[model samples]
Target: MAIGWLSILKAVPWTDVVSNAPKVADGAKKLWETVARKKAPTGTSASATSDTSSPAGQEARIAELAGELDRLQQEMLASSQLLKTLAEQNAQLVRRVYWQSRLLLVVGLIAVAGLTLVLLR
Candidate 1:
């Protein structure tokens, strides 16, 4: 089972992923910032304000819709923050994997060199 997983990991193009990780992280950060900086929609819509003669019930419904919109905006900001965090974590993991693969290659080469010298002697 572990060997199968290792093979799959080996097949991935880590260099490409590592190269793109920063861009992904940056994009996520920008998305989060853009969402966070926007002001929430005011509870009073232009239509709601323009028609002062609207019935009480209609005004109440408009207020409720406005509240729902605010809630959705908050949820969007939260989702964007989560996305930014995940992107950062993914980038960190890719960097670690890339370095680990390089280290493994160097170690394998040294081992092969040692074995060849021992055999020659």
Candidate 2:
């Protein structure tokens, strides 16, 4: 007749154990803190705690990030507008160059025709 391990585990006073767990955890935490406090160096822990933990510090950081985002957005808009303006100017320049070349070709053909007529006579 083996006393099964599962039956022994189930026989535990689970409610009483659970009720005392928090007190036990608190004691252990305090004990660990005391030991760690003795070993840790001074001033090192203070600097590791950041200002962003507080509400006002968090608000300031959010505002700074928002301002930076706005600045980047405005810069992007300005650069895109400048790019559009440059593209328009480039298109106009291309049209002007194309027409100038056509005009020069027409004038050269007319000059060659006049010289031929003069030489034929």
Candidate 3:
């Protein structure tokens, strides 16, 4: 199982992922900000305002549609925030993995050098 996982990890291009992580994070941040800053539709449509003489049933329907619009906007904002959070976490994980891979390389080099020195003696 561990070998399978290692093979999958090895298949990934870490350098490319590390390089693009910041871009992904930035895009997510921008998306979240854009969604958050958007103003929700005010529950008053032009028809609703101009047609005060209209029947009460029509007015109620307009109000219901407006409520639904507001709910959708709220849901969109929430989804954007979640996406931003996930992107940031992914970037952080990529950075950590990059550093760990570098450390492992250094440690392997040191071990090889030590073995060479011992064999030479």
Candidate 4:
């Protein structure tokens, strides 16, 4: 019953989850196969104990840290993409301003040159 609850909870259907069901199932199957194929963790190992301050608790903590690390990496990547877009937009704005100012300066210089020439003639 707990296993069934876990499957349903993990399938939260968040975002593109609806489209990912098949892939998620395949990944879960692969995880089970790999774990089952491997030699079972020896009971003699320190991590076998579930006591307070046990190695198993430390391993679980590390796994949790790793999951958070993965989520943070994804968030950083998204933020980088957004920052890149904002930088491009800012650069385009600067370019537009530079060209507009250059154009005005050129027109002003040409008007001054033309007036000076007319006055000399």
Candidate 5:
């Protein structure tokens, strides 16, 4: 089986910064995490105890991890998309406001010029 980036992200314990349980931020990271966990026994050594796990049990655990990776990926993608949209909208608003400011400046100058000419007359 080929381990991908998404697997790795999913496997990282997310509690270091965010929550009590580890949450994978991206699917790509999750994939890589999954791969790393399966290939390296260094991780989860403490969890291996109690003598009930067989090959099938390990497989079940892997399946569960895979599902978690998928869920996290979905969440990350959704959040990223929303942020992108918001950024674009912000940029557009800034542009509009900038133009409006320029227009007001020009109109103000015109009014000032008219008043000065009438005063000279």
Candidate 6:
């Protein structure tokens, strides 16, 4: 009964899902736009704004953004190297299991044969 339920869940109609995804996205976008329009600021003033448009402010913003980008790149590189190391370790583990199982199979066969000989005698 559990197997039947799992099979039913696994048998998803992906083509239908792909076809309907665009419609769902469109509906969500429209809903978000309406909500955003309702919540928009009613007024703007120059005194309330920061000097980001000035040359000095622009240079500072660019330096800050560059620093953030460099940090993110370093983090990405570290994660990628860690992933590679884990994948290599997983492959080694799989090989070790395969060889150990083969050894166990041979030992089991030998034990079974010895038991058969003793029983016959």
Which runs in model 3 stand beyond 4 Å of their true positions?
Answer: 4-54
Cα lDDT tens digits for candidate 6, 1-121: 9997764444444454566557556655654554454433424356323655788866876786686677666556655655565565556556655665677689999999999999999
Give the whole-model CA lDDT for all candidates, comma-separated: 0.74, 0.61, 0.73, 0.60, 0.59, 0.61
> For model 3, where is the 10-residue window of minimal lDDT?
34-43
C-alpha lDDT of residue 10 in model 2 = 50
Which residue pairs in model 2 clash with each other? Answer: none
TM-score of each: 0.58, 0.56, 0.58, 0.48, 0.57, 0.57
Error of 1 at 43 (Å): 21
> For model 1, how does the per-residue alpha-carbon lDDT over 10-116 read when each residue is reduced to its tens digit?
84667767786686667667667756776676566777576645688578877877877886677677677667767766777677778777888899999999999
Stretches off by above 4 angstroms in model 6 are 1-49
Residue 46's lDDT within candidate 5 is 57
Q: What is candidate 3's local distance difference test score? A: 0.73
Clashing pairs in 6: none
lDDT of 2 at 115: 98
Give lDDT tens digits, candidate 5, residues 5-59: 5544443434333541133245335555554544333345556543227787678
RMSD to native for every prediction?
Answer: 9.2, 35.9, 9.4, 19.9, 16.7, 14.9
- Which residue runs of candidate 2 sit more than 4 Å off their true CA positions? 1-49
Candidate 2 per-residue C-alpha lDDT over 1-121 given as tens digits, one digit per residue, 9 for 90 to 100: 2566654445454565566557556655654554454433325244334766788867876886686677666556655655565565556556655665677689999999999999999
lDDT of 4 by residue, 62-103 (tens): 786687677666556655655565565556556655665677
Better of 4 and 6 by lDDT: 6
- Give the local distance difference test score of model 4: 0.60
